[model samples]
Target chain A: MKSRKSLGDSEELKEINISPLIDMVFILLIFFIVTTVFVEEPGVEVQKPKAASIKDLEKNSILIAITAKGEIVFGGGQIGIGGIRPTVRRLCAQEKLPVILQVDESAPGALVVRAIDEAKLGKARAVFISANPI
Target chain B: MAIKRNFASSEDMTEINISPLIDMVFILLIFFIVTTVFVEEDGMEVSRPEPSAVQTMEKDSINFELRGTQVLMNGKNIGLGAVRAQVSRLIQGQDLPVIITVGEEASAGLLVRVIDESRLAGAKNVSLAGS
Candidate 1:
């Protein structure tokens, strides 16, 4: 009887408690879901030039791309230099933000300068030319 | 009475002390959630040049001409890889202005690369001339 009682107590102590583990797992899952953010890419792909003075950009800035073929892209749509002013103006009026020009390494220099000029005309708070760090 | 007492004690033992464990897990979860930073899109770093009211041509400026894929430093053809060394050699002791003259048909990428290389070579004031 003594041996049997000891065996029963050991059996109860050996039982695994998994409810707390389940709760922890669920909490971890919720934490990851809440923290995940979707990153959007510019539609066109261009090889950006390398620079030593590059810095990380702010999170809420607008992205503009000039492809190697000299096509201007804003918000995944093709736009001309003339389109830059109005688009930037509307967006900046809502919330003044930095405009990042992702110019292709082989695009025309004139197009890049033109884009910067138009962004200035649109009253963009700041204009940045994107480049990779060497 | 002994059997009844044993049964009651076993039932109490079956109840795991998990409140403190749950509290610790909750704290860890909260810490991870609060410290999490959403990853930003990967891209290059960008800098802004000051806008000038008048495009004044400065003296002692070195000209780099971009025609198609060929890069020219003062009308002499130089490869893209050689640009940094040559620029550093030229701008060693003085902050000579570096001007890049890009043709209308030249690639913008080449121009930016040249500008970056020049800056990396210690050229302080780099400007792009109108095509």
Candidate 2:
């Protein structure tokens, strides 16, 4: 019985404690999960123009995309410039969010201006053009 | 009998101490939660010219035209590299309104670049002419 007690003591000393490691892993996992922001694509991809004055946009704003072919896309559907005003009005009425326009580099200037005009008619608080930082 | 009972109870209390480990984990978790910055996608801010807005041609106003791929200042075709210099020289010591007139067929990218260059040159009131 004395020999068995010594042997058990030695085995206990050799055992590694993994509770701290498990706690560390759990902390890391929760950190990533809390900080991760899910970015939603606008369904249509366009080459964003580069600019020097780009600023971080608000996350909860409405997104309007203009394709290289001058197609206006909103909420995963192709919409006309006329449709922008009403949609923006409704969305802004619900939540006063800024409007962001993601215009393709090759899109016509007139279309972008028209979209801006419609967004203004909708009484958007602010308008932004999406561009990559130079 | 009392000594044997005390030894058996001491052996039973062999579990690892984890209170400090849990405290460290909680501190780390709180640090991460506090330091995390939830930054969203970014964009360049542009404001629409107000309708019924007065069109006042200030003495120090500079006109930048975006036609095709060329950037024109006062009707002279200047490269994009020279825009800042030209705008800075024209503004002198006065706050100038830089008006950008974009052609219908001109790419929006060109317009944005010209606006950025003008802003870089310290033009305070930059406005896009309604097409």
List residue ranges in candidate 2 displaced over 4 A. A1-41, B1-39, B51-54, B58-60
Candidate 1 structure quality by residue, lDDT tens digits, B1-131:
99999888889685667778677667767666765656343343322333451244344666777888888766788878988898888788797777776677777767777777887788877766566
- Give the Å error, residue A113, model 2: 1.2
Each candidate: chain B TM-score? 0.55, 0.61
Leading candidate by lDDT: 2
Provide the overall lDDT of each model, using Cα atoms, as 2-decimal numbers. 0.73, 0.79
lDDT of 2 by residue, B35-116 (tens): 5657466677776544433365444468777788988876799979999999899888687678777788788888788878
Evaluated at residue B92, the lDDT of candidate 1 is: 82
Best by DockQ: 2
Q: Per-residue alpha-carbon lDDT of model 1 for A65-108, expressed as tens digits?
A: 88988788987788888898998898789878778888888788
- The two-chain DockQ for each candidate, comma-separated, is 0.26, 0.36
